[model samples]
Target: MTFHKEDQVLYLMAEHDLATLDTVGLKKDFRTGYDSGVYRITHKQWGEPPHYAQAYFDENKHLLLFSAMTDRGFEQLVEAFNAFGHDFPAEPYLRVNLTMVTTANEILKKKVVLNEYHDLFQEDPDPESEKVLKEINAFIALVLPDINAGRTPGIEAAIRKSGIDPENARNVMESVMGSLEGLPGPKGKSPRKSPGKSPVSGKQKKLTKQLPAQSGEGVRLLSGDDELLFDLHLYGMAGDIRREAPWEYLFEDEVFGVQVPGKDLVYFVSVMGFEGEHQALSFYKGYEGLAGFLEFRAEVGRLSLLGLPDDGMLQASTMTGGLMTIPHLMLSFTDRDDLEKEDLAAIKKSGARFRGKGQWPRIEEIVPGHVPVYPSKDSLTELFLVVQQVLVVLEKDRYDDQYLMREEDPDHTILVRVPTGKGPRFRWRDHYLVVDPKWGETSYAVRISPASSVALARLPEASQELQLDLFMLPATVREKGSRAYFPFVLMMVEKLNGLVVSMSVLSPQPDLESLYESVPQRVLEELIKSGHRPSRIEIRSDLLFDLLEEILEKAGCRVMWVDHMLQMDEAIMSMISHLS
Candidate 1:
């Protein structure tokens, strides 16, 4: 019923004001270079009654009532809304909660649902429009509690419920209740006066020229799509942000990308609206004279990135520890005393030390190690090979022995934020993840997974030592789908700058020739169970590269066939089509 009367006259002067209303704080509102118009929701699994969330209005609702939540995210959003329905217990004096604003992130991503237009009020198919729609729903419950008591809606109940007489009910609510007699007559006063100024002095000079004298905030350039164009505006403290979750920051790219090495300058990066989780912000643009830096750190309430990439050019600073503490798991780890020492050196150097300690590590906030627990498919493939040996010991203990000894001399470049995940989520703070290493190079831990979890993680052929590879085999039966998905998937890149290096799964097939008849004895038994001996194998396919080169040339195994792996099979089929 048409509201926003300046937010119901300051919520009725916040009930006899002395001013107060708290709760709002759950940060991590999405950001990727540009374009924004947030407020998105839909996280329902149960807890009935309109709860899908982000309903500044509604698309789907179960019980989110967000008007900017935060009593520690409403006690974890009411215990994830009573454990998504069916744990009963809800009438505690009919709690109504409707305040908003919440953002907080250590990666809890699930966005991409924008489409809001709703205005439909049609219902006039005459036969006297159902008593003029129950006299406009009884004049909207008698003018919605008199709009904070300024009072209006009473032409004797709109002429006895629209039978319309008193001069057609004063010309039908004087053309539909003409602006409820111009609002504000209750507590927070000041109804008229603007004809010569004073009534809220033009909204206090447009909110003091949209706040920010020392209030602070930024982000400029709004409009893009050419050199990857632009569009941004968090705006001076983004107007003291009250509600706008989905935030993100790694470097928001050193302020949003500013590449000038071969000059065309084209600036990018100037947005700020991070509302705390301690603090750690990043930016560094130098290969040498792409030269720029800007880091911010704070401790205890953790935010560390203690600068270096030769912490040399341009500036801005803050300090504690150079932020790098990566841990990412997307469901299932059941328990191995929450492993750590680089997650037990990525599970005994990627051989998945369930035999040692990794069958259940990460015990953050005490026990709940990842989720979607196991029930069988051989216990989720023996806990997905002990979480694929904790992502090959988190990509071989991701750099920092002084950036791997400043990337071993010869033209160095390092920008890191690794603990990546796509398909079970974890993005560890993504600072444009670029790691350059060309002097006697070494970096390969890639995994593509699904060939029935690398055929129940084969290996044990015993000859293992090949290691420096890039593999992809699933070519079709629609990019290989069933055996409940495991028609070959493998990736491990380090031709040097190919980047990404870890993911696992390959051992479930009911066809596609038992998944290409065991890709050359399950990649020579998973490089003899990852003791990785690949001085050769480089395969990439355009329709299973001639039957994976006559099945790894009849298993003698020193394979080769990377005709630019048709751009890594269309970049892993466009990241499995934006992660399906």
Candidate 2:
């Protein structure tokens, strides 16, 4: 069932008499003390791993609870809190958490029940949620009765009833009671298993280097060698290595580093343990991911020093700059249908399982100059080789020292293994990584035809200088079983008054190169059709400059590359907003 932002379920602790002024402080203390920070809740009872929730005291003193596992549930909570402060309305919360309401009859029953506070509103709650809820009810039931008897409400037994260990339960109770007396309590122990070394050591010690050759400027042509392109042996080896070293043994912050021999570029590998949403070996190319990671760490440190809660610090860090923007090639584990037809066929041919909804291997090539797409067979082979190397390093514990590189480490040096030769030989290279703000612009070579120059020369020169930009729209179009691509738009606007002279939607059919190669002709044809050539054309993108430079210069139109085009940016934003 679809859960909308405007649907909510409220549960009131009817067994407790929490209407008194003293109850306000008690509720506040409970919320603050028991608060499990976002993404850090280790309790198995609090929803699922990674996506969990903490209880809060709303303005009305109701126990506010929600789970991130529900569709748009987290977003709804954020929106409600933002709009109405602490007294947020309950209309926008999910009426039935599918995780809780399992049976058809329970769903039907919940559909008729009004969304109001009640002691026993939730029926057939998931085992984990039910256990936790019972514990919460027990604590609330004890609060008032024990206080009236002039005794402190000890909640260790209640916490233990929820399956927490005795020590942790005591710690939780101490934290809660200490808050009442304005004393600092010890942090609760997390239930997650500590990071451990891989059980099996990888035997492979060297990388097979059949690197792709550079194709002119800003492009690399894949090698034609059969061994380099989809080597089944390499794929099998990588898979075996991965099977040996499960991601659960490593933390998200742990990076397995690799560097291509003779190249300055480095790729940091992050093995996601499936503890969070993603299950993949993410190869964050270049310095982008490293920079983002360091920045995020620094932000967290700064926020922690200021005494902010984990969620608040994370939210603030995310708002300023998040690591999600880093460009990385992810070797994801996903269902078969999520794979492109070609990718699925490749897997099938390799005798890999592809029929069921299992976490199959899929390569997501998200790099510079291209839209996110499934890698070709050749590219997939290359990526699998990298994955193999990373797994090997992970198994051998070669990256253990690199994992120790902290914020206080003066050098910030990354240990990268450089492949020396094919016979189990490699060299360790030390590279100090830093954030490079300058982004690598994708450039395409465009040849101007004499016929096009003749046609542009025939048009009369217009007084106005026009701004031209060829950019990918935010929206994407895709066919079933095929990879998705952003639609490109060739927009021409009058630089003076922001009047749109021409706009044409260009499809990245065949490939992006073909689309880029057609841009010069398209722009020229538009100018000729308009019967007037502008004196000068202003372009912000390096790509547009590259495509239009030779053609526009031959047409007696000066091409200027400026940092910003107000008209073009505004028009792009408007179109994007409209599409969104």
Q: Could you say which candidate leads in lDDT? A: 2
* Clash count of each predicted structure: 76, 2
Off by over 4 Å in 2: 1-328, 332-362, 366-381, 388-415, 420-445, 475-484
Give the clashing pairs for model 2.
7-93, 8-93
Task: Name the best candidate (by TM-score).
Answer: 2
State in Å the error of residue 33, model 1: 54
lDDT of 2 by residue, 16-41 (tens): 11232222333322232322221111
lDDT of each: 0.28, 0.50
TM-score of each: 0.19, 0.40
